[model samples]
Target: MILFFGTRPGKPETKKLFHSICPYCQQQGALTAFTVKNYFHIFWIKLFKISSHTTIECSHCKRGFYDNEFTEEMKNELSK
Candidate 1:
């Protein structure tokens, strides 16, 4: 899934604001690692797609959010 902000270009401030409100930004622990898996009829393979992923740690709440549903939703909205 891919999530994108619906804002005009050349507006860094707006982009920053949008990111701040993003669900992924609300997560903590910083995505230390990411894994991807592919299943086939005979076998399955699990590999590390990215060693490190962009992450945001909450300073006050100390919470973690690694949900990708937000991005999927954004993609769906854009398709419509």
Candidate 2:
């Protein structure tokens, strides 16, 4: 499916977006959180942040996915 961003042109939008489905349960959802790591001279620190978008958890398996991973294809048909 084609996705649009702002009402006008030259706006930021997503492209070539798609969702990742769970192989075991066939459930689809967005990414809710991610992990980040900071490296120092001799040590490394890890941090996790929750995403702004709502996360979808599988009812059966209780697995969660984040929205950031999903991609959308921006269409310029409106400008035509």
Indicate which candidate wins on lDDT: 2
lDDT of 2 by residue, 1-80 (tens): 65333221121332221244544476454222232322222122223322222333444576654555332311121122
lDDT of 1 by residue, 1-80 (tens): 65332312121111111223334445332222222222222122322222222222333454433534335433333234
Scored against the true structure, residue 49 in model 2 reaches a CA lDDT of 26
Write down the TM-score for model 1.
Answer: 0.22
Lowest-lDDT window of 10 residues in candidate 2? 71-80
- Runs in model 2 deviating more than 4 A are 1-18, 30-33, 41-60, 63-80
- Candidate 1 residues lying further than 4 Å off, grouped into runs, are 1-19, 22-51, 67-80
lDDT of 1 at 78: 26
